[model samples]
Target: MNSKFRALTFILFMAFLRPALSQSVENAWVRRPLPGMKLTGAYMVIKNDTNKDISLLEIQGPDAEYYEIHTHENIDGVMKMRQLKKLKIPAMDKVMLKPKSFHIMLIQIKKGRLTKQAKKTELTLIFDNKVKLTTETKLSKGPL
Candidate 1:
């Protein structure tokens, strides 16, 4: 191959490969809210496809006043939720957020808006590398 052609090919390959090797978010979903309750939970899968670990800085959305990254801790047989400053996803590993585990807590829902039925909501996840991932989740009524 010509030198110039080879150089151009390398550049193009890097451009496409960068995103695949970097951190990414996948399979993000939120639990349905309970009837007559303003509080709900969100879950997602964070995958660090790169060779380096990534830290999730924050989570935000329009439905709640404040979104917190939290984890359920079992203290003396009592499970309690606690705020987590940051969530770490190891390199080439996947972290699953589920009920009674690490989750995103949506607090202080805006009043006067109906949220009893299932609807699609958008959430912005901020990472330490300044990458923002916008994911859609279906909001439904939680178990009664």
Candidate 2:
């Protein structure tokens, strides 16, 4: 291939990777569960610093046996949690996962995972472009 064509291809590839590279997870925290409770919720703000949109595919972590993206909606005057297949983060914007809204459901937490000294959990968020972001979230009593 010619040098001009090679340069154009490189530029296009970089552009494709820009949005995935610019995305970041901020202010992530998992609420402390009540005694004898094995389930809890986590919240965070996903910031998109790029000029293009991005989507979150799924989440995985060692703290819990199961993790799901969930949101609460009012159904017939009753609010209930609903699982989401994917969450979208708009271009140059932020998506916040908070209580009574979009958040992460952590089920069947690992035994003794939340110790006094270890007050944080590591979560890996997978995106549409196969980009994985590993973030450490501190434990909290409520939204900060």
Candidate 3:
């Protein structure tokens, strides 16, 4: 009976602690689509509160036909957009995805996906550890 009680206690403890172990998204927003533009950008701040590093695998949303993790690199004095396979967030640290740095590229945006008025969009962030986080973003004029 003592062992069963201990197991139950452990389970309850983990259940309450699971959320703290996951990555948290903050300041998530997407750029307003320009006239006849098929591509736009999304920015956010991701915080990993867990003890272990987290790998960002992919991002998906219905606002765009596809999405990719991208970073700007200076190659030969020219800025280039490089597609990142996985972005790592160090334990107890935050990674900022912003313009001219690490950001999410929304390619082939669906027509009328965005408007002058801010609208909330759903974004699914997939991690290498099989953790999926669904975050909402408000369409904005720019990263700001």
Top-lDDT candidate index: 3
Model 3 regions more than 4 Å off: 1-19, 75-77
TM-score of each: 0.78, 0.79, 0.81
lDDT by residue for model 1 (1-144), tens: 599999999999989877667666676777766656677788888888888888999888888788899999888999998999999999899898888889998887767432655467888999888889888876654334
Could you tell me which 10 consecutive residues in candidate 3 have the lowest summed lDDT?
Answer: 111-120
Clashes of each: 3, 0, 0
Ranking of candidates on lDDT, top first: 3, 2, 1
In model 1, what are the clashing residue pairs, if there are any?
32-140, 32-142, 33-142
lDDT per residue as tens, model 2, 39-111: 9999999988877888998899888889999999878989998999999999899999999899999999888
Write one digit per residue (lDDT tens) for candidate 3, span 48-140.
998999999999898899999999987888999999999999998999998889999999988778766548897999998898999989888
TM-score (C-alpha, index-matched) for candidate 1: 0.78
lDDT value, residue 124 of candidate 2 = 91
Instruction: Tell me the spans in candidate 1 whose CA falls farther than 4 Å from its real position.
Output: 1-19, 112-114, 141-144
